[model samples]
Target: MPYARLLTPLLLVCSNVFMTFAWYGHLKYRSVALPKVILISWGIAFFEYLLMVPANRMGSTVYSAPQLKGLQEVITLLVFAGFSTLYLGQALKWNHWAGFGLILVAAWLIFLE
Candidate 1:
């Protein structure tokens, strides 16, 4: 389908946002009990699975498994960077960017024909 290529990445982005928050948003509330945090995270992750499963399924039509994985990782890094900076109030240093750049290169390699 013509929409698969475009829609897959969009769904992945949405899914990653929920995922990044589910995994890390609790950091802002360190005082919360561990059990509560885990429960909340699980609840958030439920929405992530809702999008991620379909994203992978639809993405498979136009992209190989490895390509879909590469795309997801790249998108994860990008989403995490923003979530870490904005949501977590953490600054990304130069080395962080450098490491992410290397990962980007790896993703490029995965995409290569």
Candidate 2:
């Protein structure tokens, strides 16, 4: 717990990277069989769980459940934005930014008393 405040978010970011891949990495391989894609995604998701479990447990020591969840959501959006643009070559639209901005606002409010 020496760096739980810093380490928690770092772990969360790493976990979200794996999760974005597991949940959306199959989109590039439309020709792949559904069963195969499912298997591959599940395999990738296992790594996500490994990091996510510890992140939540350690984060809980410093942040409330709602705060932790909000933090994770923000991390997810940030990670997915990069993955979508760089890995998938998909450009994010203005609308996507607006929507994600609102979510960021919501995450900010979660820390409020």
Candidate 3:
């Protein structure tokens, strides 16, 4: 369980990172043909699922299904923000950070006792 505890979040983070790129990186590939972009995105998504499944299973032991789902969503946003900022050269605006803060609050409420 201890290992799973660590592994769950780590795996989720990795999965989110892969998924963020798989989903949004294609926007940068607009110059490329759609078919090729779709194929590459599909390939990246396969790795996302590979990590996501284990993360959910492992996290389920320590967290409720809803909690795990919320965690995944928060991680997804975080990973996407990082990917967009670094790879897409997008800046994080105050409104964006505020929105993320609101999401974190929602996650906290969802997991609250």
Candidate 4:
């Protein structure tokens, strides 16, 4: 198997962690000024972009554009679920897990040859 197949997801996973923080990690610090928060989020998102761009570039070597996009979405969901539960102390209800499972099934369809 091409290393791109493995490397792309790993980079994407790292990207998503930074993105999750950029997007939602500041909820715990509502008192911070909005400009400061936005600026901080932008800084964090810069790292996300760094990893994401390379992941997509390498992914294109073996995966179609649509496949790469679909895989990214699934990976985003999985990463966000973990981030929300652990870092944010949010409990995932059954429906959330069921919804994620359904999404996974849909994602699996993308890999069919």
Give me the candidate number with maximum TM-score. Answer: 1
Residue-by-residue lDDT tens digits, candidate 2, 1-113: 67899999999999999999999999999999999999999999999999999999999999999999999999999999999999999989999999999999999999999
Q: Lowest summed-lDDT stretch of 10 residues in model 1?
A: 82-91
- Model 2 clash tally? 0
The lDDT, on a scale of 0 to 1, for candidate 4 is 0.92
CA shift at 51, candidate 2, in angstroms?
Answer: 0.2
Model 4: lDDT of residue 54: 93
Root-mean-square deviation (CA) per prediction: 0.5, 0.7, 1.0, 1.3
- Candidate 2 lDDT at 19 equals 92
By summed lDDT, the worst window of 10 consecutive residues in model 3 runs over 21-30
CA-lDDT, candidates in order: 0.97, 0.96, 0.90, 0.92
lDDT of 2 at 59: 95
* Candidate 2 error regions (>4 Å): none
Colliding residue pairs in candidate 1: none
lDDT of 4 by residue, 1-113 (tens): 47998999999999999999999999989999999999999999999999999999999999988788889889999898998889889978999999988888887888888
What's the ranking of the predictions by TM-score, best on top?
Answer: 1, 2, 3, 4
lDDT of 3 by residue, 1-113 (tens): 87887889899999988888888998876799988988998999999999999899989999999999888879888898888799998989999999999999999898998
TM-score of each: 0.98, 0.98, 0.94, 0.94
Task: State which candidate has the highest lDDT.
Answer: 1
lDDT for each residue of candidate 1 in 1-113, tens digit (9 for 90 to 100): 78999999999999999999999999999999999999999999999999999999999999999999999999999999999999899989999999999999999999999
Cand. 1 Cα-lDDT: 0.97
Model 2, residue 9: displacement in angstroms? 0.4
